[model samples]
Target: MTYIWTGKRWAYLAMVIDLYARKPVGWATSLSPNSELTSNALKMAYESRGRPEGVMFHSDQGSHYTSHK
Candidate 1:
């Protein structure tokens, strides 16, 4: 999770990167960092990548990632 300054206020930015391409595949912003934020970014990446199977995910061990949500 990263905090971005939007000139007026701070926002949370979540991103999914394509390691092979070293580029961002998907991203999402929210006022708060939560499961929904990361989930949405992953969802976008999944859809963009044609929904590949047997994919693995990694995270920074944040509560949002560990949460049941």
Candidate 2:
């Protein structure tokens, strides 16, 4: 997780990178980091990438990622 100073307060940034191209494919920013933040980024990446199959995801063992939601 990365925190950015927006001048007034800190904001969270979630990003999904296309490892093959070494570029960012999707991203989201919010005041808080939660399942929604990560999910939204992943969803955007999935849709933007044409919903490819057999993809692999890696992340830290955060509860948000482990949540059933």
Candidate 3:
């Protein structure tokens, strides 16, 4: 997860990468850095990859990533 300045306000970005592929498979941006942001990115990656099984996820353990929301 990261944030970028969009000229007006900061925008939060959540990304999911396929390490084996060394590329991003899904991403989402929002004004708030929260669990929903990460969830949306993960959901997109899951759906885009046809909802594969036994997949593993990794993160920096940010609050949003660890949040119960």
Choose the strongest candidate by lDDT. 3
Off by over 4 Å in 2: none
Which candidate number would show the highest TM-score if scored against the true structure?
3
Candidate 3 residue lDDT tens string, 1-69: 888999999999999999999999999999998899999999999998999999999898888888887
Clashing pairs in 2: none
Off by over 4 Å in 3: none
Q: Each model's TM-score?
A: 0.88, 0.88, 0.92
**For each candidate, C-alpha RMSD in Å?**
1.1, 1.2, 0.9
lDDT values, one for every candidate: 0.88, 0.86, 0.92
Better of 2 and 3 by TM-score: 3
lDDT of 2 by residue, 1-69 (tens): 578999999999888899899998888888998889888888999999999999987878687667777
| lDDT by residue (tens digit), candidate 1, 26-69 | 88999988899988898899998899999888887888778887
